[model samples]
Target: MISIRKILCPVDLSKGSLLALKFANAISGRYRASLAIIHIMENPHLDIPGGETGAFSFGELVNLYKEERQEEIIDVLKQKGTHAVDYEIIFKEGVPYKEITDTARNIKADMIIMSSSTSEKSEKVAGATTERTVRFAPCPVLSIKTDHDQEKREKIEKIGDLMDMSPNVKRTILLPTDFSEHSELASNYAIAFAKEYKADLIVLHVIETIAEVSFMSSVDLPGYGTTSIYYDGLLKDAQARVKNICDKAIEQGIKAREYIIYGNPRREIIDIADKESVDLIIMGTHGRKGFSRFISGSVTEAIVRNAQCSVLSVKHPEHNFV
Candidate 1:
């Protein structure tokens, strides 16, 4: 059984934090796991009951200093169905990403649920704060978008919510792969998740053709004569790899299929998720800032931002997320 003992949800109590809060609460309710709410204060000083620094500009801290509104934040969660008494409120100081990752590890959290920035400038992603936390978190990261306006939006809802709406329908899950070690690791999580839900899994491999690249912007490319040959060769290789993956799952009698397509990996992944009505997209969190970590294109980031389903980003095995 996939065991989840604790779920850590970091929120600023912003409108963006609600959808993530809903997911966290739903998952905790389903798994009967503990849930904790945390609001990180970037500045350590600023009238922190006793006094430490000049002033904290994070806004929530401002209220904590002047009005003592911590309980008020808890009340908001209470109104939305999560009992305030069921969770402990964590207040920490330092850089947002560092504090978040540190808290997850210190508490042995099974998963970190937070909202990603969906602004136009962000390439529809988790932004710097969410991305860095996912990069260093000790466990799997559930990065959600802060796009809910009225009620829960379908685009941000995943398996936790699905478990509430439909318990008998076989969920379709999409897992995009690049054949990298990180992607391989993600496949393991995907397999485990599929077994948990008894769902059909679709392994998708997208080939970024020269034509698709050119469509995104002005880029010079080789003629179809050369490009088409390279495309065919790449497709064959991807097909062989996907077949192996599907065969293994099918041999075990798990519903599995393979899809190979030539297009922008980012766009294709999102489109396929919507088209298939996927419950979740389990993929590798393989993005790095500049030349720091191994640089994979932000295809994973885009999928987290725009996919019409919740995403589970599995970090490298080197990271401790147990």
Candidate 2:
């Protein structure tokens, strides 16, 4: 039921953003998802303390920049569109990151596809914009570089309307879970993707570390019954989690299977993806911040760096958790 039916591609009219727009167009053409193109002007209200004295009047400045950026964006869109794809462009004033996130939420977009600068100045090719958008987006965000000659790909009005661009889940899909609410959320997406393509769903949950019992039971136990009991609890819980996920898929009448393993989360996630020959990995992030963010979890970052297949990282809306 969770489908990528609507997509948001926020552009700043940079060459990279334009490349992102083309990529979004390809994906939207494949799935028949609506494309909402957004442009956000940087907020002008804030300045360093006592640094605003020489600033121009707000109204005069606003009108001036608006006319300039709006014209440029319109020209870019006109150049980008072909006869087949339908897209809507939105111009708003606010913080780039906030407005992008807000518009995606308002439109209930299933994904956000954007281009990242591969400029040497950027430490990560994914870029800070891509990272921030991924951190906050309610749906999947595919941050791709401007590769693949666009002149070669055909065009379509809708995503599902085009068979060529339809993703091949049959080849592979990498799923990572921490056994959290949002991890289950990623499972929902992965299951649907697998079902659609009739692909093998390699459901994976890593223990992150060997359990204390497993570590202590180095020597053989007195009876196999007690040892079985110890492992049973962990496996039982994992089975139930996997069952709940599979149940959602079964409701859609799709055949789905699962796997559970023990190891470091990031390494296992990448390893299984490589071993299974997956095309994508769908996982979840908690989006923790500040000191807590610094000291603890960053499975998304690790997997993104190490994964061979594409990674789709999902996070709950802020309100969804609270």
Candidate 3:
């Protein structure tokens, strides 16, 4: 069984953040997890003349801002009726991603939930904070999209209706894998979520035809054969692996299915999710950094950016809470 004791959610007070808060609140209630809602105040570069500096010190201005933000957050939580689960509001000043990740580590958070989109006035590029947090967060990160329907947004405005509008994810969950250790970790989360929501699970593996061609062009190595024979063998092997995973899910009382496709893994994953009307996607990230991340370009990040449904990016934690 999986356990989620603590969840951290960062909000910038945008409509996007409101949408994310909705998910965080609902999931926390479902798991009976403690929730910490944080807001990071970016330093405002005040170019005041020396003469007017005495009117209010920078520290005083920050304090004033924090007071206003606290009131706003309290009102938001009240409107959403977040009394079902234990929750706290934290205010900090610094870089958004750094503060969010640090708070999660400090709280030993089991999960981090936040919006994948940024406000128009944000200084950083769109999705930059979310991308950074996903790469560096100690635990799994679930990012919600802000592009919901107008009707949904309207529903959000109605006080005490948040629980009804929150995502239940009771339809289908999509998990894309390459069968690596990272993918194995993600599979664990996929199974846990499927059981929790009583949702069907779909495991998909995509074989890159370009890689197949590369393999075929190699010199006839020992235990190797013609291209057609090699392709058939590869397909059979993938089927067995995918089926094994589905079998495990079935044993856990989950409705599960497997799929094997030939194409780019990233593109195929997103396309299939749309075709199947998947409610969520759970996948693993290598947490690639610096030059390697730039060169290879993370497939998980690409999917998170493009997928219509929410995405949960899991990384192996030092302590396995789930």
Q: Which candidate is the best by lDDT?
A: 3
RMSD of each: 5.7, 6.8, 4.0
Candidate 3 has an lDDT of 0.78
Ranked by TM-score from best down, the candidates are: 3, 1, 2
Please report, in order, the local distance difference test score of every candidate based on alpha carbons: 0.71, 0.64, 0.78
- The digit string of per-residue lDDT tens for model 3 on 193-294 reads 888767799999987665526544644435756555666787998999899889989999999998898878788999999899787899998889999999
Model 1: per-residue Cα lDDT at residue 258: 88
Residue clash pairs of candidate 1: 45-53, 138-321
- Can you give the TM-score per candidate against the true fold? 0.75, 0.66, 0.85
**Which window of 10 residues has the lowest lDDT sum in candidate 3?**
43-52
| TM-score-superior candidate, 2 or 3 | 3
Best by TM-score: 3
Q: Residue-wise lDDT of candidate 1 within 50-152, one digit each (tens)?
A: 4554344556555564344366555555554433226777877678788888888888888888877565353233356776777777788887765644344
lDDT of 2 by residue, 1-322 (tens): 4445677888876666766676577667656667888877665334222225646677656666666666765565455343215677777876666788888888877787776554534324335666677777776776654432343122212222333325442445667777888787777778777666655667787765444446335444456345555555677788888877777777766665677887678777878877776766778777776788787757786665555445667777532211
Q: Model 2: residues >4 Å from true position, as ranges?
A: 2-5, 12-19, 30-32, 39-85, 91-95, 106-108, 116-126, 144-169, 210-232, 243-255, 318-322
Candidate 3 off by > 4 Å: 44-54, 80-84, 118-126, 151-170, 211-230
